[model samples]
Target: MAFERNTQETYYESIIRQGYSRRDFMKFSTYIAAYMGLETSAIGQVAKSLETTHRIPVIWEHYQECTCCSESFIRSDHPIVADIILDKISLDYTLTLMAASGHQAEAAKHATMEKYKGEYILCVEGSVPMGDDGNYCCIAGRSAKDLLIEAAEGAKAIIAWGSCACNGCVQAAYPNPTQATPIDKIIKNKPIIKVPGCPPIGEVMAGIIVHLITFDRLPELDNIGRPKAFYAKRVHDSCYRRPYYDAGLFAETFDDQNAKEGYCLYKVGCKGPMTYNSCGTIRWNNGVSFPIQSGHGCIGCSEEDFWDNGPFYERMTGLAGFGIESSADTIGKVAAGVLAGGLAAHAIAANISKRKELRDSIRTARENEKKFES
Candidate 1:
């Protein structure tokens, strides 16, 4: 378990090695800054951090789930994100992408864990099954629980990469057979950031990494440990069809005309109002479209136990909260009325001002006439 951390490499060093220009690296940094919703002034900070900080050593562990998280990482739009995060990322040690197999791979993980102990980042992609002493997941002859504990022991921080690792995902859904467990449930000490989604959006995943690289710290996390920048607003808050929702218009069925007309999907079990994610604003697949934009209701995949939340197509049984259903229903009408009233008030004020001016002129003329007579 004894090892040494990898030397920090300069951005120029990585650029030369990767056959990319220094300009290319800077451009990537700028894109990253923008994607992370950073201010224009923050481009410098992002570039500076990437240029100086050595590539963070990462131990990405996979457990009782599909490899979608890894899949998403490799497909990030930014060239730097894909290259630096997955391909070159594993040039160090990741079980899925690492070329070394069997004992060699195991040895590599151990070496990185030891050498970079308490310095490397741990990226866990799946849930650990605690039942049967963690028999549900075994890697290279080691139980998943044992592997997680061993890997987490020397980590600087942990990133729960998908709903699986963050909230036990589907594997831990209702009547969970294996008793899947999230990272925070087992690893107590490290600062764990949960990027919860069935499979989180690629840029969101990359943005987190960039924020960490740039800020030299985790981005601000909400109560659930998910980054607030991406998970702060409900998907409904930014949906293009939100005005329709506020106007009491809704799509009763997926194929209804209202649906075709881009009416609100709340009637079709759209969880947009309840779920929080950047999907509506940042839309998946290079900002092309998200579920709601593609004529489908938001399944709310980014939330905890979403799979167990019930049928994705079932409408919410009843409206909750006082004004949300009633008052919000008339929002569009209310806003319009207020605007009209404001215009009328301005006109009345203007007319009064003009009348006052005319009266003052007449009085002044009369006073002049009297003075001349005297």
Candidate 2:
């Protein structure tokens, strides 16, 4: 059976029907606003929008992926985030979460697409396999590529969830037998928001949806189509061990005493310095901890082509405009050399000034002695 809903029902009405108080709704708004880096004034705006706006119809698609994105989204730290965005909201069709399956599921998806054409958000959770005439991955006897094109034609926008949908993840790695292709590559006309991670932070997933629901528009994106609010800073910039990195105190190995003392993990193949994400700040598992906090170095999962970038346990030797083969340790060595040279020059200049002072004193003494003799 198709899951039915009242098309005119607002989000707040649904929340209230679900037994959430106005206070709970406001609190959720505040929490989401904070996560979005919105000003305090915007909390009311967010609340107002959610209260009055009808829930957006979302058709979430699954393709060539591990389904980690779905796992992460449902396990969002905030119970209400999962409840409101996934359940109360008009998530009309999702292969993984919906009760309807087989023909019933297909019926639900097609109905939403036709009824809400150019309005419903098409959320794709994986990549499309383009190789072998798109035969590697199929759903309902159709290639993922064909289904994606059909769905995207009527979508208001597309949310490419996780690295798989954003950048083809592991399936698109070396030799890519399936030739997995990201949604953005397949859909050119639509506005696609890329949230890239092995499985992005659950709160981040919720925040993006809330942003869309609040503003009736996509959040401000960076150069690569990722939301700026969460991906603006590098993980290294907010990492707790940043001080150790600046002081050149790095853990040489995962089991070293320096690691126990909480030194920077840069030398042990930490990719935090190169990775842009909110992991250091927002954290994972309801703000309890993330990879870095758990003593493992960041694997730089958010960046494009991360699987092909380099070995996970090795630090990046160079980034764009950083000079070829120049690692952090090399830069530190050069900085130390410059500091030593500057100190030596300062000492030499001080010595020269002292000698000049001595010469002047002797000249004054000689003149005084000559004046007394005369």
Query: Which predicted model would earn the best TM-score?
Result: 2
Q: Which 10 residues in a row give candidate 1 its minimum summed lDDT? A: 316-325
Query: Residues 187-236, candidate 2, lDDT per residue (tens digit)?
Result: 99999999999899999999999999999999999999999999999999
lDDT of each: 0.83, 0.90
Model 2 alpha-carbon drift over 4 Å, by segment: 1-3, 316-374
Candidate 1: residue 59 lDDT (0-100): 82
> Which pairs of residues collide in model 1?
3-115, 4-115, 118-154
TM-score of 1: 0.81
Work out the TM-score per prediction: 0.81, 0.84
- Top candidate, metric lDDT: 2
